[model samples]
Target chain A: MSLYIKYPKYLTAGESCVVVEFADEIDRGANDAVMNLKKYLLTQKDISIVECLPTYRSLAVYFDPTVVSADEVINAAKSAPELDGEECASSFTEISIPVCYGGEYGPDIANVAEHAGISEEDVIKRHSSKSCHCYMIGFMPGFAYLGGMDESIATPRLTNPRTVINGGSVGIAGKQTGIYPIDSPGGWQLIGRTPLRLFTPEASRPTLIEAGYEVRFVPVAEEEYKKIEAEVAAGTYKPLITEAK
Target chain B: MELIIRKAGMLTSVQDLGRWGYQSSGVPVAGAMDLPALRIGNVMLGNPEGAAALEVTLLGPEIEVKGTGAAVFAGADLGFSVNGKAVGSWRSVVLKDGDVITFKGPRGKGCRGNLCFAGGVYIPPVMNSCSTYIRAKIGGVEGRALKIGDVIKIGEPAALWKKLEGFCLPEDLDPAQDANAPLAIITGLQEDAFTEEGKKLLFESEYTITAESDRMGCRLEGAKIEHTEKGADIVSDAIPLGAVQIPGHGMPIIMLADRQTTGGYTKIGVLTPLSMEALVQKMPGSKVRFRRADVSEGVAEQMRIKEAVRRAKELRLSHVSRTHSEAPKPLFGHFILTVEGKRYEITCEEI
Candidate 1:
């Protein structure tokens, strides 16, 4: 692992926000930089930062222009503690998501396997092999942008996207993989379905997984998936959040 | 104070400033599109600028007042009437328990109107706001539009400045009114992604707001801005207020209050706050142009509006003091005054 030493660009977004762009391309280190800046920025009380949006490669710091100046916010963002490769790998609540792949759950699993020149079983194995880092949660509520997809299973998105993809559907787009927290029209190649509710609007914490967390998929049988779904609907299903050792 | 919905119009929902501070999890700032109008409506009634109000679309709601209170109809005049008698817009008026508020006749200059009460609309704040994000099913009146027979509870006005009826905001100060000048834009966010001709067309050509335009975004039909080989897609990033995103189709879509947290399109520019106010008022099929502007212009306009709202509140307070013959309430504040990097704590107390 190498230390993140690249300087960031401060792009002004209208009069209300300033985007601290760490990288133009999606870089893991840049995403970490964004998360670190956001984590540090929230602790400061001097700047009247109304809100913050941490993306894959940038962090948009929102504030009321009537109260704080862009220059001041830029200064505050600049002062965020820089991290080395080791410190950047800070402790994260590793969220283990149980997924049921193939058949009705993942309609495009076969398509993805054919496109990648691999078997459907190999596709699932590769997808669940590594722990994908959650870069940012966006699009729909609780939709997580999970990076670190295995290049062997990398596939392009479906040309004709479905009108409505079910919530908790895991999919892949180009080199990136993500979860559709809610039902939405999407182009990503469907691979699996998770029973856990990513977005519980009525719950105290609206979103289950957040940015800067890690998500690992554990393949479950159809019966187990059905059992978990019932438990979730009953409000008795607790997501397995284990410490990453 | 309480209100009952006699007839819920096309689209009427409770809205405050916005659901602020939460965007990372994909929550949008769903509030009144005509924010200035909403703010002024609240201000005229001696309510805080961000107090919850009923944002009515072209066709306004018919409400049966069940409790006596003060209310003001601001923004696009939706032909507000009480007991079938027409009333003026932008003025604070007393609402009796029996008063029936209705929207009759043709629509006004703007698309939306804000019906504000002296005391804010008393709805539980979801994520610290009453603004309704219908798509997310969060915030305001059960996170949905007010339907027939829905009860609306009103909160008590701030003790410092209670509702003072008869305070009318001058037409000149109304933010719902459009400016003669073109919309101002802080240009060139992803300037490289667009050709020079594309950039010029953005400032020169007239854009017609399409029918698809709503709170989430205003889709525009205009000159096709040429995209570079890089195409329109970029790593998804935060969608700023008034972000002019030119997609692969070469047309521009201006992101608004209910836009998603982040987007992948190339944003060529961000519209100034004043431009946003003016743009929201323009009905579908109306034309709009953009002019180059800097941050200072926006800041100046914001300060101007803030000062006006502050003065209006003070003026109404003065009138209340004169009528009641009461001493002003106690006020206290603590401020950190920084001069040339040197910090100083400043405190002021009204004794």
Candidate 2:
């Protein structure tokens, strides 16, 4: 399969890492390029390379400068085969996250509805209906930075960030929406919370959602949330994962 | 052998080189703030450079050596003592079972100190690292700082080389006496985001280290750096160690060993490895200035220091003879030594 994608501009992150910029804006194409390059680089298994961190519009390649130079990494990355549309489209895991909205679970649901000029039910429907792309995982471990939030539900972050937001709290800030993997200080407007474990150090794969995966929130009742939370606590609940439709 | 903590002072924790290869998974690479000192202390005891050592911050822990072993203290002179007798820094000292080791508050310019045992601390490795990432509660003892009544096991002692016991790092290798040393910086990922004036201000002005500084980053109180466009926010990208990020409020935060994997603030530059080492040694109110250095220059400086460390290690080894009781036994076919991050194997017969 032949595909033509523009080479990204390489910038130095430090002596040991380089940031490859595909575009200036946070576009889907840029994200795809970043993930594709990261996958391609991993297959090479270069000893000099340390880790590749994929973000919205760029990929940061960390390496040992003592073993390899930035120019060498850039040259290798430039020569990597461009991924075909079908190849890029393949291998996306769709994860269904169970979220309980409104009431104590989401304190800012009414406020979000007011800001978006919609009913509380409409806010939940708009949030859970569309599938969002996991653009990157950062800020905290297993915390997935998602993209593709509906413009109608866009709300501003709290002026004063809360000292602690509970783990699994689903929140939206500006054009982005994500789940908190661990309790942390945050400014995002809370709309809902997931019962599933987004991050656990004990698990073989600590983060449930990886970059480039599709995340869809399924609204559940408060009682169901508690049931699922219990199942998770008992190590019996398996997260629902299916091929992206 | 084991050591029990009698008095856990300030923030004492077990640290090695760092937890690496897990940053992509958002795990902070937590380790000793002063890595050079950690390595020096470990090497002095004939332990691998990456061996887990006790990282004593500001104040120091009072420890009771449960079994006989040799120990070395490196970095800040925290007024180390054994049984009320004063001991010197940067040298290996033989210890007997039931010996009590204690330290006074830092009497020197540096803030952090490292105590390394001959065989290294035998903490279980998490994600392939013995280093403690306290925020995540992973690695080291219960993933937190040492508390009173905690007992840590130490590995088997290296062969006893009496002649090498008193060797110390030369005074020149220690951090410079000036507290306001200029830290070398390489222009970073978001350098273009800052205005020309901002870049000028960074190198021209002096910044005082804030008390909020920790292993995560050094929050500096300095002149506000002007941003040309989005004012300090970014699309959230990987944060390299030593990154000097300017937040919306414009104060620079130099990301360190315990920094989060990625951040949204715009970074103007990153401190050189040596500069990072020097920056960690400074106290809260210490002043700092940034000096521009190219990547090659920074790498070269690191290599130079590594070479110096190699020479220092050789100097200690030269004092050791085959007849020394501490020398590796003939039953052990090989003696493994870590040099400049590479391991070299020497046959016992060859020595």
Q: In candidate 2 chain B, where is summed lDDT lowest over 10 consecutive residues?
A: B315-324
Ten-residue region with minimum lDDT total, candidate 2 chain A: A1-10
The local lDDT score (0 to 100) that residue B175 gets in candidate 2 is 37
DockQ of each: 0.69, 0.58
* Docking quality (DockQ) of candidate 2: 0.58
What fraction of the reference structure's interface contacts does model 1 contain?
Answer: 0.79
- Candidate 1 interface CA RMSD, Å: 1.2
**Model 2 regions lying over 4 Å from their true place:** A1-7, A158-161, A243-245, B161-164, B170-181, B312-351
User: Once superposed on the true structure, which residue ranges of model 1 sit more than 4 Å away at CA?
Assistant: A1-7, A117-119, A155-160, A234-236, A243-245, B105-108, B158-163, B324-351
Q: Write the per-residue lDDT of candidate 1 for residues B278-300, one digit (tens) a residue.
A: 88877788888888888888788
Tens digits of per-residue lDDT for model 2, B233-306: 88778888889899888789999889998888898878887888788888898889988888887677567667
